[model samples]
Target: MTELPAGLHEFLSKAGWEGAEIDPIPGDASFRRYFRVRRPSGERAMLMHAPPPHEDPAPFLLVAQWLSNHGLRAPEILAQNPREGWVLTEDFGNDRMRDWLDENPDGEESAYAGAIDALVELHRQEPGPFSPYDMPTYLRETSLLTEWYAPAVGLDVDVSGYDAAWSEALEPMLARQKPGVTVLRDYHAENIMLLGDPRMGAPQGLIDFQDALVGHPAYDLVSLLQDARRDVSEDLERAMLSRYAGRAGANEHFEADYARLGAQRNAKIVGIFTRLYKRDGKPRYLDMIPRVWAAMERDLAHPALGPVADWFARNIPDDLRKSGGGTIK
Candidate 1:
């Protein structure tokens, strides 16, 4: 490996981690990297390797502390460098919900129930600061979609139609959701660990939650139920949405808003996946376009989103329909 930071090796060595046993671990999304360190006591810990100036570990640490205080399982900060942005945290073990389901595809329903339960309990927790989830999600995520309609796609949406239509469609629908709860913006398959509890049974461990927001209860429902990588099936998705609504005491209008938000969210994702391929050289995201489109199409059919439905019906390039979600060009 290339030379590490000034005191990294020495600090771990002093912390009782030996010279011979550091291993690189595959990381989830984001700019930071991860490594596993073993102590002389045979205890294992995770070292967050982030380049100093770009990635900020403060929000993550603060959020972790806040969630832990609210009674969820969050990583304990064992060691940290506020300046260089390195931290050592407790390893909660390797069995994440997605990995387990992939190993046993037939077990998706039961395993995902655990994942759903984690979300239920998390939503039950009281509020805290730095809502990682709200309006920024609109500007940050929806803007990604606009990039795809650039000249590169040979479709000059160089117009503001998408922006105005999106705002008109989503804001009122978002307002309808039973607001005031912690919504994890990306709480899908990979971020949750199915930690089977001894007393409670099938509890889940959460991670990658630095993007929590204080917004609609339907937001997390859309995040989990309408995952881009795989279909959750209509029946199961319905059952899960009902479960979340029941726990949150949401009304019929809440269910309607969920459908509306799901459509809006999937549309944004379709734009994002296209941008990833054209701008970032990540072609695999394109494979998900069809699935995301399918979800959005389903949402467009919902009666509550009538205005957007009308807009999409008229505006979505005709060629895209025949090509089964290919680019407008």
Candidate 2:
């Protein structure tokens, strides 16, 4: 990026770093981009490439510092190029929970269990400076999934009822969530890493977290257990939930709230998968829509989601029970 930003190469050389290799990490929904830098001493660092005015690294940098101060391993910010909106961060490596799951299919539960612990620990952190992950913003963003599925396989049925059910379900559910510290908003498969530390425990490396937001306590849990990109087995999902519930000291009320929140999250994921396929031209996310739907259906079976469940039953096709299974929203 612009000839390695003059003087930086000299700095790297002086720091005993070898040549910088640009390993372009995959793109996320936001404008931010990432690259991994392999150093001479086997030390790896990541370079965030947010092209100019769109996304400032200030918030990310700020949060990283805040988290690290709390004894959390949120990449050490080694260097920065403010004008380019680029920052060099300690590489947590590529062994994300998802990668570990994919690469070692047998121990998925252990890895996920560790992730749940990390989330519980993350939530346990003392309240800090984090921005709100507004409910309105979530609602708006979640609609992208519905919007995506609506046109993908072509369905124009009045989704007003579906929308209404979502709103109804989220009202009490969101109210139950205590929006305390900055929730990483995304605490799912890809962001969490398997670390070697007993303290951070569970698994270790985490990435793709520039979109962190202070949000509902249930938000990140739902994000992890009901991931849009992965099919966490039913048994594993249950076990992980139990672990998180125990750590959070969640009671009956919290259980109900967690299930309801799961519904909201899955619904949002369904819409997001559809949107990724149709709008973002990223069909890789399409296949996972059904699982998201399945997760929603499971949650819909809960008594607390009666009205919403009934609405979905009456409107959405049984085959399409999970977001896009029926080729409609």
Candidate 3:
């Protein structure tokens, strides 16, 4: 286990877990870390250690309260000290959807179906008090590709054209943000927990959602279907898309919108993964960039991404595009 962050003992003492056993939970791409907290009384919870200056626990608390109040399964916050960035939340146990599906590959459809149902249910309501997923945010995210991935791979591409292409491509997605739903930005397999029986319907716990935003409904769906860390089959992808569209009463333009968001998101992930390796000195993330790159290429093929696709064609050659992941030499 990694060294416990400073102030952890004090934080736990204030929350009434003075001598509790603390075990480290593996972290994600961000600076935040998690630990499984167990008390002498057999009580259990999770400690989110989000160090300040890089992470804030306030949004996690807010979103947790909001999701809980709305009958969703976000982890309940037992205690919080936002100033020090410590939050004790309900422990959802350890059945992550990704690992579970790895063992039970046959359960893929059921798990994805449950996830889709949750999204459909969530999107039925008005968005919570959060910032909009506007054009500026989209552009900033897409620029990660040029800012990090392009340069690391030795491509001196036209940054202006890249931005312009995304600006043109993402306009329609921005236009559909009226009364948006809360998009759990990282709603992928790794972030979703299967609380109880894996075969059970919708008994899943949501985590790593502090970065939630009011965005297009299709964005989360894209995150789930086009996962960077795992391979969701095209057959399953198509079936789930149809399932969501049919259940949500999505418009005729939904497919195009889904493709658009998928491309934008994949682009961001590519840049983010690259940044994780080059800037943060974490090379493990490089392994996932190829998966994200492939998904981005697929999304770029959509008619909605003509400008962005053309930009890629003109600037990023086949060699750089194909060798996007670990071979940054």
Report lDDT per candidate: 0.70, 0.70, 0.88
Best by lDDT: 3
Poorest 10 consecutive residues of model 2 by lDDT? 1-10
Residues 1-329, candidate 2: write the lDDT tens digits.
33444455554554445497657676657677777778556668887766568888887787788777876668888887656676788887767777777777867766777777777877788656766666676667657645766566665655677667667776776554554655776778777767653233544755556667776677778888888778877888788888988887775677677777787777677777777666667767766777777788888888878877887667556655533466632
Distance (Å) between predicted and true CA of 197, model 1? 8.5
Best by TM-score: 3
Clashes of 2: 12
Q: By summed lDDT, which 10 consecutive residues of candidate 1 come out lowest?
A: 150-159
Per-residue lDDT over 1-329 for candidate 3, one digit per residue giving the tens place of the 0 to 100 score: 47789999999999999999999987767788989989989899999988798999999998988988887899988999999889999999888999999888988999999899888888987898888888889889989989998888788999998998888888877778777899989999998999865566748889988888998999999999999989998999999998998898888778889989999999999888888888888888888888888888888899999999999999988876776543763
What does each candidate score in C-alpha RMSD?
A: 3.0, 3.5, 1.4
Return the TM-score for candidate 3, rounded to 2 decimals.
0.97
